[model samples]
Every structure is written in C-alpha cells, then in structure tokens.
Target chain A: MNDTNSVVSIKDVKKAFGKNVVLDGINLEVSRGQVVVICGRSGSGKSTLLRCIDQLESIDSGEIRAAGHLMGFKEFNTKLVPLKDAAIAKQQRDIGMVFQNFNLFPHVSVLENIMLAPMKILKRKKSEVENEALALLERVGLPDKKNAYPRQLSGGQQQRIAIARALAMKPKLMLFDEPTSALDPEMISEVLDVMIDLSKAGMTMIVVTHEMGFARAAADRVILMHDAKIVEDAAPRDFFEKPRSEHTRLFLSKILQH
Target chain B: MSWSWPYFFDYMNNGLMLRGVWVTIWLSIISMTIGLGLGIFAALMKMYGNPAVRFISEFYIWLFRGTPILIQLVIIYTGLPQLGIRFNVIESCILGLALNEGAYLAEIIRSGIMSVDKGQEDASRAVGMNWRERMWLVILPQATRTIIPPLGNQFNGMLKTTSLCSVISMQELMRSAQMIAQIEFRVLEAYCIAALWYLLLVSIWGLIQTRIEAHYEKPFGSQEAVSNSEK
Candidate 1:
C-alpha cells in the first residue's frame, strides 16, 4: 500500500464497536487526483472505512496515513500514541469530509457556514475568507444562496452548501459518505453533478455511495465490500463488465436489478 | 372586613413604595444577569471538566439548590458576622439570590445544551474547530434556542422571589409594604399595592420574553413548516 504519490494509505486497518466488527484488515491506497468509489450492502464497511480515514472513527490496529501525516497518532518515543485534540485538529484541516446529512449549521446563513472554519480555525483575514467563500458558493452553483438559512433550502440545495463549506478549507483530499443517500430521488443528480465536477478538477476523493452510474461514469476504481472486507477492487469497466468475486456478482445483481 | 380604597391608592402612590419597586427591579436584573453567567460556567464545568472540577460544580449546585434561599440570605447577612465574616444588606441579598438562581439555571442550561442534535457536534469537529470554538461558536448558539424559554421562566420567578430578601431587611418591595402596613395599620392596602406592582413587572417581562424568543426562532424558520418540509 506504500506509494510515494499516494494521498491516503491504509494498512491492515481494523475497527469494531463492542461485539460487532465494522472494518476488518482493510488495505487501500488512494493516489493523488484519483476518484475512488466504494459500494457495498448496508452492513458492509465502506462508510466506516471512509470515516476511519478522516479519524472520525478510530482503528483498533494498524496504520492510516493521509496527506503525508499519520491520521490520529503522533510518534512519541518511537511508540504510537493518540495525538491531542489540537494536533488532531491540525491534521483534520487537510482532509475534508461530508456526511450523509448536510449537517450545515442551522443557526447561520449559508455564507457564514462556508466562512467559519477558515476564519476561526486558520485565523485568516475576514475579507480573504469571505472572497474565497463566495467563490466556493459560485463553484457549487449556489452563489445566490449566500444569505439563506440551511433549513430554508431544499435537501439537495443544502447538500451543495455543505460541499461548498467543505471546499472553503482548500483540503488535499475529500471524503463523501453517502452524499446523496438522503435526498429525494429527483434531487440526487444536482448533488452528483457538483461531485463529478469536483472529480474532473483533479481533487483526490473517496466516495461511498450506491450510485453505480456515478461509479462507472467518474470513478477511476470501484471497490465492493462484503462482510467487513473489500471483496473486489477493479477499474470501473472490469468491475461492471467482468467482476471477479462471487460476492461482487451477487451484490451487483441485487443493486442492478432496478 | 374593612378595606379602604383611599388607603390602597395612597400606598400605591407613596414615594417610599415607589422606591421599593425600583429596588426590586434592580435586584432582579443584577442577580439574574450574574446567575446566568454562573449557570453557564457551572454547567460547562459539570459537563466537560475533570472529575475533581465536576465534583466542585456538582456540590455547588446541590448545596445552593437544596437549601431555602431565605435561610441562605439570613446566614449571609446575620450568621456569618458571628464568625468574623460579614456582608451588608444589599450584598447578601444579591449573593443569596444569584447562588440559588445559578443552581436551578445550571440544570436548565445543561438540558438545553444536551437537546442540540449530536450531528451539530460532528459537523463542528469535522471543520477542525477546537473544543472552545465548537462550544462557543457552534454549540452554544444553537443551544440558546432551547435555553431561552426556560430562561425567561426563571427570570419571571426571580422577579417575585426578591420579596424573600425583605426578611433580611433589604428594603425591597415587600419590606416597604410591611413597613407601611405596620405603621398605618393598613395591612390589606399595603400588601395589595405590592401585589399589583409584582403583577405589572411580571407582565412586562412576559412580553419581552416573547419578543426575544421570536428573534431566535427566525434563523431556524417556523417549527411547523420545518417539520412538514423535512417529512
């Protein structure tokens, strides 16, 4: 999994809650500007793996490196110890994440949501951050929604604002955890369009989604997870046309039926 | 059996009674403001501090809330002087009221902060905000929506509770009423005037509370419409 150009490296990552295993011995490498889509059944570890990469969920054993630094641990006396909150926060600045729910701050206008992290955490100049935030809003095709509250917008529009908010940090990598899973069926395409544009602009991304169309259209590699392990990993063409694993075949059948 | 309308009117217009009402208003305003600050501090300590810090806050809240405010006032104004510790009348009244008010408000504030969605926390953390930034900028603003209604109710109670300080000879509204009653033998009229003042003060606060609540509600949009659209 070691690669000089890799933006993210996961080796033998294992995570569990109580008695239930969520991610088991996962190994992956995401190179710079690579668009990776991981698809699986509901209980598969795809989402958890994405969360682990962002240090939102801690791994029980093994290592995860992102943006040229350890994810959640700092080397102390040649032994790995968990970093403090401040250090962890510094690491998180480089890796942006979007949840299934938009999770925008309901109390603020959309523009403030985009401006807050850069201004407060990074201590950037207000005028500079405000300009970048407006640009990001324009990038997400919501330039007109600067003053709108999150609750006032439709779910799809809110998700776009969430994407703009994440982009305001100018992160090295982005992780999307079911970005469109909560939207109405008709609203899914608008959010996906923004993601596809992001992928085209050469931002490193790892997406967890059930949208096979998106996987085939924009992904460099498609991965199938089953029973807490990655069962299949292949280029999009081979993954859809000629999957190697029996689990991939059955999973594909179930999802592709409709 | 003998209630005099003329005496009631005279007491209501009395300069002493008017000053007493002013004192009561000042006491409520100052104590409630200080109590709110203490409540926020204590609640944060109980929620996020280490075990020792948590125990200190827990004990403060328990001691203040469990005891009667009147006894606490008496102890501060009268009893403490026997041990070479003394506070004047005004200071003791305010200290007792604020400590008691803080204990109750701590619980109210804690519950309000807890009611905020866990997702809000996750989002704030994802943005690389430190604990202080997250609490102050993100969590507290949202928690305030839930905190306001109960906070208003607490202030309303505080307006009336200042009467207890009269026992400590603080010369607030109730004390003035009692003095007038004793001197003029117009107990009914004097007390009635005080009651009317209390009713008037509480009514004004109720209106202001409604306005503040409405202002906070604006960012979240109407509750009914949000729920319907979300569904």
Candidate 2:
C-alpha cells in the first residue's frame, strides 16, 4: 500500500491488553497536509488510535504505516521481531505528539523545553536550536516567557509551549491528544488559536479533542469514533450537520449543548 | 572545680588529639561518600527496577534499618573477623558506618524520588528522551531538593556514629580520650576535653551544612556569593 498521497495509513488495527480491547479493527487514513480532528466519548479508542500512529502503543494485529515506515511487529524470515525502544523513538520523532496534560518538562525553562529534542535527538548546535526555539516562541506569542519554568506559566501557556516544543522537532505530522481538555474554559482559546494558526500554515495535524468549535472551524476532515471504531468520517460541515451514526449524533448533541 | 581554660587549650594542642580529630573528619567524609552512592543506587533499584531488584533492595533496607546501628557496627567489626574476613580498625569502622548509613539514606532517597510528580517522567519521554536521559536530566534533579534535608540529617547521625568505632579500638576522638584518661588518670578532664572537641567539630559542620542548604535553595544562580543585601 505505497500510496504517496496519504501520509499515514492504518489497516485493520487492533489493540488489546489481555482481554480488555482498546482499539478494535481500526482503519484510518490521513492525507498529506490535511488537518483531521478526532472526537469521541471517553474510552472510544480515539487517543489510542492516535498513539498507535506514533507506535507509542503497539497494535496487536494489523499494519500501521506512517511516512512510508511500517509499524507493529517487523517481519524477519517468517518470524516477527518487535522494534526496540530506540527504533520506535526514532520513528516517533517524525510524528510529534502533544499530550492532554501538557506534559512539559517541569525542570526546564520554556526555551530549553523546546530546544531539547532538536539538540539531543537531532544533534543541532545549541545556538542554532536556541534561535529556532526563540522564533517558535515568538510565533506562539510567548517569546518573553522563554526563561520561565512550566510551573510559572498558566495552563493555556503551558499547552502552547508544548505545541511549540513539538514543532521544534520539525515533524511532518503532529498528533494532539485532547490538547485543551485540561485547560480552564477561559484559557482554552489561546491554545486553540495557536493550533488554528498551525492548521492555517498547512501543517498536517490530527487532534483528539471535544472542542466541537475547533473541529467545525479548523478541521478539514472530522472523524467521530465509537466503541473502538471510526463510526463517522466526513468533512466538518457534513459530520456536524448530518451525522449518520446514532452514536455520533448523540455525542454531538451532548457536546454541542453547552 | 570549674572548667579550666588553659588546660582545655593545652589538650586541644596535643598532637594525638589533633590527629584523632583529623581521623574523625576523614572517616566521616569517606563513609558519607560511600553511603550516598550506595543509597542512590538502592533507591533507584527500589523505584524503577524489576521486581527482583526491588526485592533485594527492600530486604537490604529492612535488614539494616530493623537492627540497631550498634549491633551492626559490632557485627561488621567483630563477627566478620570470625569468618576470616579481617579488616583494619579504620576499614571496619568505615564499612560499619557506610552499611548502616546506606540503609537509612536509601529510604530518604527513595521517598525523595517518589515525591517528584509522575508527570515529569512522562514529559521527558514525550520530548523523545530515552529512559536514562529522562532519569538523569529530569527526575533526579527534581528529586535533589527533596533528598537534601534528610541527607543532611543522615550526615549528622553518621558523624555521631563514628563514636561507635571506639569499641573496635580505632583511636578516633573518643578512643583517643579513653587512652589519655587511662594514662593520666584524669577521667573527667580527658572526657570533658573530648566532648568539647566533638562539640567544636559538630558546630563547625553545622555552619557548613547551613551554607550548603542555603546554596541549594537559591534558584538558578552560580556558587559565588554576590552580596548580603538580598538576605
């Protein structure tokens, strides 16, 4: 399935731990340079699907291919060999993931947090990384907070810094897992605005969030997941206006109520 | 009679007592270093290692902590020789102190590492750092703030525990005083002088410890003192 058109593709992906099934026979295709937002109720395998894309969570069955690299167990002469942690990390570097909790390294300053990946993994020079980090911070409108610790920043600012930290790796695809779910209601817009800017800049992004307004306004394709499967996948206008699945419709109505 | 100032000064200047003080200082320093290194390793093993490693570390801590330090010292100094594992007086003293100190320090360090928020490790991994890098750069530095006060207390305890080495005839400060008292038949004067010397040394260490703690307390600064105005 060497389709150059799609940046990420999943075929019949299934993930389970013992008897607890998390993602069941999931199939997803993310096109190049398209912003896709995934929405689902809790335990719908939305975040799990995103994690599988980055190979943070391995799939039990099926194949995952991202940026032309095959995920899951690698085949070796009819035997399967799991990739080592370093190999998986190298693959994940191309797909930056922003966590729901704004997992900023609390010991580091905002600038160091952004510069760490490029400096350590990418092995860029300190001055070069610092300059790039400053530019990213400026773009996110937190250049003045370059030296502030994550604890010193508000939740919105921390998430924005997290976004900037991800961008420092210069990843081809960005994964955001409930990026604003932990933020205050008032502080959510600042993080959303930064993501909106990234979308406008044509960065390929897959965001798992309940922010229906963001899904409607910024997403090129909005996907609704239910029971470990993608129940509805369509353009934002169609998915929100005319959801076919009862689960999708019910989720929308509940989320869009207030 | 009240304390004699001239006699105290004369005792302080005695070569044997001065040498004993030096021995005590060096012994504490070496033992503390060994204890700290072992403590940190034990703590990490308890927290992050596999179950086998955790079990071994737990048993070590339990065995050392559950028993009395005096008994532990005796076991190291006296019992080991019975098994044909003989060490010199200083060596036995250091071994006893380090083992006992490591056990207590292990608990202190383990609690310190645990006190750090779990999010820090997750954050480090999210940034593409592997486990070793994450532990060294992120988790341990945050753990240092919590570990230091207890570590300081352990140091103080270890300093006093050096007196236990007198039983093994190590000729440390207490033993030196015993020897002098036996020769001069001045039990009160000799013991009083030894007490004053120990007090002097501990007081000096107290000052140094306060400075060390203060140094760590300052945020994002070099070791060089700028001015007293801020204080």
Candidate 3:
C-alpha cells in the first residue's frame, strides 16, 4: 500500500553482499511520528534495513522511499537510475541517523560536532546554528560539556551528543542503529531516556534495539525478523503477550531470560 | 695542517657557505611542496580511483620506492640528457627527490586514511555530506592526527635527503663543502663546518615538528587522547 501519509515506504527491497543475502524482500512502512522497534538475531537484517533506509547500503533490487522521495535513484521514463552522490546526499537532507559507535569527530569539540552538519551541509547561519546547538546540548543534559572532545566524555554522553548532532539538522525522521549496543550496562538508560523523551514528543524513529523495556515503553509497534524477513509485526502489548510466530516467541524467551 | 679554531671560524663565516645554506633550504622546501602535492593525489587514486587509475598510481609508487634515489638522480640528470630529454641540474634534483618522497608519503597518507573508523564516513553521509565534503571536512581532519608524526619524520628525512643532490653537482651544502675543501685544502675543517650546519638545521625542524604535533592535539584535550600512531 502506497499510503500518502507514510514517511518511509520500503517495497520488496532486497540486498545482498556478494553471495550472502542480507535483506530478502523486506516490505515495511512507517508513518510520521511512528516509533517502530525492530529486534532479531544478528544476521537477520535488523541493522541492514536501517542502513538501507539511510541509503548508506545500496539495495540490490526493489525500492525505498523516504519522505516521498525515491531513495538513491532518479526516475526517468519508468527506469530507475542511480543518482549521483551529491543528488543522493541532497535527498538525505531530511533524514538523521545516530550510529552505534557515536562517531563524534575527535578533531572537534562536542559543540562543534553538533554544529557541523547544520552549518556545513544545510548552510544554516552560524549564529543561529550555534544557539540551536547549545540548546540541544542542554536538552540532552550536557550543556556544560560543550568543549569536551569525544575521547574525554563517557560513552553515554557521547551518544547523547550524537543525538543532539543529528537533531541539529531538524530532520523529519531519525534512525537509530542499536545506539546503546556499545555502552556500559549502567549507561544504557541515559541514552534510552533521551530517546524516550523524543518518542513522547512525537518524533518519527526506527530503532534496531534489543532493549525490550524500551520497546514496551516507547514503541508503537514491535517487529521480529527471521532469516532476513520480517516475520512478525504487532502492537507491543499483543506481541509481548501473544506472539504469533514461533520464531518471535523463541526470540522473546531468549531476550527476556536475562 | 694543524687544528686551528680561527681557520674554522673563517670558513664558517664566508658568503659562499651562506649561499650553500640558502640552496639547501630552498631545494628542500620546493621538493617537499611538490612531494606533498603528488602524494595526496597518488594516495586518493590508489584508495578510491578505478582499477586502471589505481594500477597507474601503484606503479608510480612502486617504481620510485624500489630504487635508490641517487641512481634515480643520476638517471634523470645524466642519462636523460643522452636521450635528448634534458633537465637542468636543479630540475633534475627536484624531480628525483620529489618522486621518491611522494611514494613514501603516499603509503603514509593511505594508512592514515585507512586507520579512521569506517563509522566516521557513515556518520558524515548520514548528515548529508557528499564524498568530497566528507574527505576534506571530516576524513582528512581526523586522518591528519594519525598522519602528522610520520609526516614530521618524513620532512626531517627529506631535509637530509637533499644532500644527495651534491652528486649531481647542483651545488647545495655538500657540494659547497667539497668545492671549499679542494680549493682551501682545509678538508677536515670545511667538511666539519658542513656537518655542524646540517645538525643545526635538523634540530630546528625537530622543535617545529613538536610544536605542530602539539597544536593538532589541542582539540583532543590531552596528548594521550590522540594516541601516537607508529612511526
């Protein structure tokens, strides 16, 4: 279904790395302000789907549309031609992504890291971008750590600053690729709390995470992927209590065991 | 023939030795500038260019790095003249030193670029940075920290390597020493003065390299924050 209001629409998208099939005929949709949580076994394409949506990983076949724009390509005479890197980058202006590693530039400070994209890519005015960056650092609860470098800050703080960096672009949709996977156990909740605040305030997010508490608290729908296909998609309450697919049931048992 | 401090001071204070110092400094500076230009292009070609371009760049690095620079200097200066493709003594020296320096710098640069976490490139793309923007603004900025110390070593090495140009009779520091030695017959004193000059120049560069490394590391908050990459 090509819904007019959908922020992201993936149609039978398939991706492979050489001979290994990564995403096999994945079909999904996310509406504006929807929080979709995806969890699965490591090779089940949970993170690949997020990368595909971001166009960092090219799909072998099928199409992904983000914010009504066809991703990574231009449509000419019913033929799909891959767009130039600049064109693809322009199309990605509305998408913000936070990687698992935080990836804060070590050469710049935290405030500069948050200010860089809006000032460079979007060409926003420097003073305005600086104000917004400061406000975002405050929002993420690290206003005083503006001058600190990524190596100086703890993992949780770095991830929070990464989120602030992404939001400085004022993107329409945000993608989180297991944002907390690299953090210490005690630090996970700090990053999750920022994400939960974003969810409560109506941000469109697609998160690949194993945090079931986050899923139950902030997710609109929970999806389970098995062998590169999304095998189960249901409301959190329904999926947690009455999972339909045996794969998801087994998956939840394994995760919840801890 | 006896050791004399007055004779040594006289040799060191001459205008001829001053000109020799100028020639050595200018030769090294120009060669380094050319080497840096060639090195950046060669590194990018090898890492990101198509197969054909990559092969060409690889062969260029291989040809230069595989041979002694003195032999290359002789070939360019003496051998090419016989083939009717003549370069002046100065041009020949620059061509030889720059090509050899570029090859080593290329490998140093490529490794520095490779050492960056792949996630940095992904993060740049996620923020809508194009390939060139990411390379210049993001990747190179981070790669430079890893690239600098080795680059400093390369620069100091390049300074000393200019001595080889004397074999081509380009009249740099060593050539001047030879000329002064043969004429004045103060062989020991003239060569000793040249040795002292070389040592002083290298020591000055070492101090400057340390300052540059400290400046680049300032953003990281501590020297340990940006760990030293292998030389």
Candidate 4:
C-alpha cells in the first residue's frame, strides 16, 4: 500500500476486541484531496475504519500509514516501535476528526475550545491563535458563537463549531464518524451543508454516515461495508446505480427503498 | 446541671477554645489540600499509569482506607518508632488525615474522571493533546462539575473526622472541650458547647456547599436553555 501519491494507505488491517472482530483484513488507499464516503449498517465497522485511519483506535495487526509515515509507530533503526503518547500526539496533528456526539468542551467558551490545541500543543501565541480561531468561527458561519458555550448551541450549530475546531489545527485529512446521527431530522442538512462545503474546498475526507443523499452528491467514491468487510468500493454513481455484491445490493435496496 | 454563662464567655473570649477552633480549621484546610492533591495523583496513576504504578497506588488507597483514621493516627504517631522513624505530633496528624482522606478522595476523583464521555478525550487526542494535556484541558474541567458536590460532602465529613484526632491530644476543638470539662468537672455543659461549635461549623459549610453547587450549576443549565432558544 505504500505509494508516492497516496495520502492514507491501510494494508491488511485487522482489529478485534475480545474475539469480536471489528475490521477483518481491511485494505484501502486514499489520495490527497479525494472525498470518500463510507456507509454501512450499525455494526459494519465503518466508523472503526475511519477511527483506525486517525489512530484513535489501535490496530491489532497490520499497517495504517498516513502521508507515508506509520500511523502509530516510528521506524527506528529499521525496527518499527510504537510511538509514545506525546510523539503520537504531535504526529496526529495533521489529521482532523469529528464525532457523532459533537464532543465539544462544554466548560470553556467556544473560542477557547478552538484556540486550546494551537496554543497548547503547537505552542502558538495566544493572540495569533485567537485571531485565527475567530476567523475559523467566521468560516464555520458562527462568528457570534465565539463567546458561547457548546451546551448553549443546538446540535447543528455545535457540529459546525466542532468542524471549525478540527479545521483550526490545519489538518491534511478530515475524518467524520457518524457525525450527524445524533442530530434531529431537521438539523441533518445544516451539518451536511458544512461537510459539502468542506468537500468543495478540496479537503480530503472519509465520512461514515447514513446520509445517502450526501454520498450521491458529494462523494467521489462511496464504499459500503458489511459484516466487517468492504463489499463495494466504486464511484458514487456505480455504487448507487449498479452495486455488484449481493450484500451491497440488499443493503442498498433496504436503505434506498425509503 | 448548673451552667456558668460567665465561665463559658471566658472560654470563648479568651484564647483557649478560640485557639482550638483555629487549630481545627487550619488542620482541616491543610489536610484537605494535601489529600485532594494526592487523590488526584493517585486517580491518574490508577487510570493511566503502568502496572507498577497502578499497583503501588492501589496499595496506598487500600492500606489507608481499610483502617480507621484513629488507628492510622496512632500508628503514625506511636508505632513507627520501632523503625527508628519519629514524627512530631502535628506532622503525624497531617499524615494520618491526608493518607486516609486521600484514599477516599482517590475513589471519588476516579469516578468523576470516568463520568465524562470517552469522546471528549478522543476529540482532545484528535487535536494532538497528550494524556496530560487532555486531562488538563478537557477531562478535568468537565470532571470538576461532578466532583464538587461530593467533595463538599467529604469535607463536611472531614470536619467531624477531625474530632477523632482529639484522641491524639492535638489541642483541637474537641480536645480543648475535654480539657475544659476536666477542669470544671461540668462535662455535660462543656460537651454541649462543643456540640454548638460543631453545629456552627457544619452549618457554615452547608451554606458554602449550596453556593458552590449553585456556582458550578450556573453556566451549564443556562447555556443549554440559551442554546436551545438560540436555535
């Protein structure tokens, strides 16, 4: 899976927890500026795959490389060693992730939440991060929410702030894990609008969602996983219009019949 | 039961019981600070440290919490001399209080830390925060909300626990009351006065606890309402 152009290369990754295999022999490669949408049933390991890309969940055995560097290990003297937490933290700064729960820091104001990583981890100046955070707030269409606490905002607005928070780190790739699943039915499109906008701006993204409309409209490729394996990976049109596998066909019919 | 108002006034206005009250307050404050600090460290150790550290921390909590605070005070003050270790009374009192309180506080702190959602830490890690950074910036701040009310209750209990330190002859409020009772031979009256002081201190703490709870509650509740209406 090591290639010159691939931004993320996952080769034969396998992860399991206590005999419950979540990802079984998964292999994938994502290039820079590509938008990939992943859809699957609740237990299909789509979210785990996205989390594995960011090294949020440790892989059991196999390689997860982002930007040609191993995700959770450092090759030292020709031997791969698992990196320390602090070093992995520094390595992970290039990736941005958003969760279904919109886990914003509710204790601080939204501005502080956005500014914390840059100021603390990156050791950037306060005023500098402040200005950039304010700009990010504007970009997310939440200029006034700078002083607001996360719990004060609706789920849609909080998700936007969360996206802004991730963007503040200047990440090379974005991962969304069932981001809008917790929102109300009416609030889904607003968060999707933000993701669509992010896609249009050419941010590399791997999204795990149930939103088929988003997949059809925004995805370059749509990957469908079933029973811990990706059964279909194709262009959005082919996936929706001409899915090949029996599992993919059945899953599509069930999901799209609505 | 004859009561002397003048004698009681003398005990209060003069420095005897007043100084004792001061000693109790100072001891409780110092012990709580030390205990809370140790509790936080132990909680982190139990939650994230290597097996050796976790083992040591668990042993510390288990040893201290398993015994009575009174026995702990006695052992630290009297028993360690067999090992050629000697501590002054004040130091021994502090050690006993802090070690025992730290064990209980460690469990409280651990529970508070666990109450927060894992996604909060995941988000912190996503942004390149190390474990310490995630704790300082994300987990502890949220954990603090759930931690305070129980902490206040613990402190209130600590105030009463300090009475047990009286057996050590630490010149605290209860010790002073006992001394006065011995002198006047009016044990009931002296104890009643001690009871008043205890009631007064605990009542003050109850008020402060209410305020602290309200202080922490202020932002989260209002913020939710505001966020909802803003949408």
Strongest candidate by lDDT: 1
Give a tens-digit lDDT track for model 1, residues B1-231: 499998988998898899999999999999999999999999999999999999999999999999999899999999999999989999999999999999999999999899999978878877788788889989999999999999999999999999999998989999999999998799999999999999999999999999999778877876556445434
The candidate scoring highest on TM-score is: 1
Candidate that would win on DockQ: 4
Encode model 3's per-residue lDDT on B73-110: one tens digit a residue.
99999999898999999999999999999999999999
Residue ranges of candidate 1 with Cα displaced over 4 Å = A1-4, B223-231
Which portions of model 3 miss their true places by more than 4 Å?
A: B79-86, B219-231
lDDT of 4 by residue, A177-200 (tens): 998999999999999999999999
Q: Per model, how many backbone clashes are there? A: 0, 0, 0, 1
Weakest lDDT window of 10 consecutive positions for candidate 2 chain B: B222-231
Query: How many angstroms is residue B197 displaced in model 2 relative to the true structure, after the best TM-score fit?
Result: 4.4
Write model 1 residue lDDT over A26-117, tens digit each, in one string: 99989999999999999898988988887777899999999888989988898999987778778888888899998999998899999999
Residue A192 miss distance in model 1 (angstroms) = 0.3
Q: CA lDDT of each candidate? A: 0.92, 0.83, 0.91, 0.88
Candidates in descending DockQ order? 4, 3, 1, 2
The TM-score of chain B in candidate 2 is 0.89
lDDT of 3 by residue, A187-247 (tens): 9999999999999888999999999999999999999999999999999998999999999
In the order shown, the chain A TM-scores of the predictions are 0.98, 0.96, 0.98, 0.97
Q: How close is candidate 2 to the true structure, as a TM-score?
A: 0.88
Model 2 score (lDDT): 0.83
True contacts kept of 2: 0.30
DockQ of 4: 0.62
Question: Model 1: which residue pairs collide?
Answer: none
